[model samples]
Target chain A: MRNLFAFISGALFGAGLFISGMTDTAKVQGWLDVFGDWDPTLAFVMGGGILPMAVAWLLTKGRRPALGGEFPTPPAPKIGRNLVVGSVLFGMGWGLAGLCPGPSLASLSYGGFGHWLFVVAMLAGMMAAVPLRARLAEPAEA
Target chain B: MIEQDWIWGFVGGLLIGLGGAVYLLVNGRVMGASGIVGGLVDGSGMRTVWERVAFIAGVILAPIPIYPIYRTVETHITSNVAVIIAAGLLVGIGTRLANGCTSGHGVCGISRLSLRGITATVFYIGAGGITMVLFRHVLGVI
Candidate 1:
């Protein structure tokens, strides 16, 4: 039952990504190109997405999940180094490829060999992150 | 068709939000793509691997049936292998380090008014825009 809902939600998100032109690298690049011919469609998507989610967050308040698990607590408000550095790195990659994680996975079937290569590399990077993060955290701990 | 893209984008955004909402309200988990797959890559989510796989399966498979009807999926990603690899690595590592991606931070966090989410979104988008200017306009590499 839990898995079923997970699947359904994933499907919905996938469908939305496709319909929103997020699966298109050109569209994403255009949006990022604020100095160039800026595409404002992504803003609409962001705003539209936020509306329902804000309400959903509200609904989650003082409530447990309908399923048999505790709802995730809100993340602490602390602004850390990892957040800044990671975001900058992620943004650079996003600008270069115009493909974020969601679209990267969603576009696999239609995206061909090049997309496959990207996914493989992305996975390698993910694996490397565990050690990389530990090394990054070491200095703080010390 | 192009001029009215915002409409479709908004509609799609709603679906994406609804998906996130469902994932949170029912599954008691944040709908973060990179985190989900990252757990699989880093061996941290070994116990709940099936659930992660199920969600990913939905993301990958959902588009197939809907492709015929929607048909707006084109990712004009660069064919430069080096760029692709670099971008992929950056995205993978960056998302993991940050512990979130566009979906997790941008949508889920921002909707909840989490400062971390908003900060990540701003930095990423800002960095992406800068990268675009440097690469596309200034350097002309990508």
Candidate 2:
């Protein structure tokens, strides 16, 4: 049941990306162009997403877990260098490729050859993290 | 038609976020799209498998309803296939290293006001941006 719910949620997300012109690299690139031909459409799409998410968060606050299991909401972090650094990286990538991981996967269903490249590289990136993860953990222990 | 395209994307993203939140609320899950899909091949329980399949299916089929109102135009950006693949691999590695994707960290985690999530999300976004700047501006891939 949990898996089913997760799948449906992903589908909705992919569908959303497809409809929002997010999967279209040009649309994303347009947003990245700060000075020229600025397209604010992606902002609207993001805003649209935030609205519902905000409400959902409010409604679920202090509520017990609902799926007959515990939901561990991770602790918030202090605003620090990590936040600034990560956002910059994310924005740059989004600007360059016009395909974030989520949207990139959605583009695959449409059978775009380009999406295949993105997905394959994404998988490779994920695999590369294994060593990085071990290194990060080692520092914490030491 | 163009106007409608934007509308559909906005609305679709909104709905997907809402659906994902609700599913998470009801199912005691985080609604990480990639994890759900990944679980399908990992031999999770029947319920999980079904949900994962359904979510992916919905993603693929959801756009059908909106297709009539909007025609998508393919973007033309020239880059070597190998480069694109490398980028995707990097993203995949980043997600795993961070323990979540954008949706899981950016959307769901951020919504819950999680600090680690926020940190991880920052890393994901930052890494992406740096990669883009290097690829597009410095390296001139696109």
Candidate 3:
């Protein structure tokens, strides 16, 4: 049951990504390209997504998830170095490829070999992050 | 006054949010795509392996049926191998370090008014725009 719900949610999310034209690298690049032919569609997408999710957060308050576990709570909203540096790095990649994690995965069916290569590299990066994070955290711990 | 692309984007964004709502309310987990896959790669998500697999399966498979109806799904990912590798590594490392991406931080985090989410979004989008200007205009490499 838990897995089923998760799968449904994933499908909906992927379908949304596909229908929204976010799977298109050109469209995504257009959004980032403020100087060039700018695309405002992404703004609408963000607004549309935020409105419902804001309400969902409200609903989750004081209410346990329908499933058996407790709702996962967010940690303190800290403005940490990792967050800033990581985000900038992410943004650079996003601008370069016009593909983030969601769209990258969602578009795999038709994204061809280039997409496959990107995913493989991304996974490798993710693996690297484990050790990298540990090393970065060492200073703070010390 | 809404453009056709905007309409699609908005609707898709809403669906993505709705998917997030379901994930939170039913599965008691936030629908951060990178985190889901990252955990699997880093071996941190081994305990909930099935759930993660199910969600990923849904995301990948969702577009299969949509392809027939839409008839075309274009990703436009760049063919430049070097750029692809660099971008992929940055994205994977960045997202894992920051702990979210467009869907997770941009949608879920901002919706909850979490400072970390909002900050991350700003940095990433800002960085992406700058990178776009640099790469597309100055460097002309991407």
Top TM-score model: 3
Docking class of 3: high
Docking class of 1: high
**Tens-digit lDDT track for model 2 on A1-142?**
6555655666677767777787788777665654446667766676677677767777676785466775555544544443343344444445556666677766665646777777766656555555655665423324
- List model 2 lDDT by residue over B56-116, tens digit each: 6666666556555667645443466765665565555445545556566667766676776
Query: Candidate 1 lDDT, tens digit per residue, B13-92?
Result: 99889989999999889999998899999999888787788888888888888788885577798989999999999999
Candidate 3 or 2, higher TM-score: 3
Error of model 3, residue B66, in angstroms: 0.7
Candidate 3: tens digits of C-alpha lDDT, residues B1-142 = 7788999999999999998999988888888999999999999999999899989988888998998897376778888999999999999999999999998999999999989999999999999999999999899987
Stretches > 4 Å off in candidate 1: A138-142
Whole-model lDDT for model 2 versus the true structure?
A: 0.61
TM-score of each candidate structure, all chains considered together: 0.96, 0.77, 0.97
Ranking by DockQ: 3, 1, 2
Which should have the higher DockQ, number 1 or number 3?
3
CAPRI quality level assigned to candidate 2 from its DockQ score: acceptable
How would you order the candidates by TM-score, starting with the best? 3, 1, 2
Give the DockQ (2 decimals) of all models.
Answer: 0.85, 0.44, 0.88
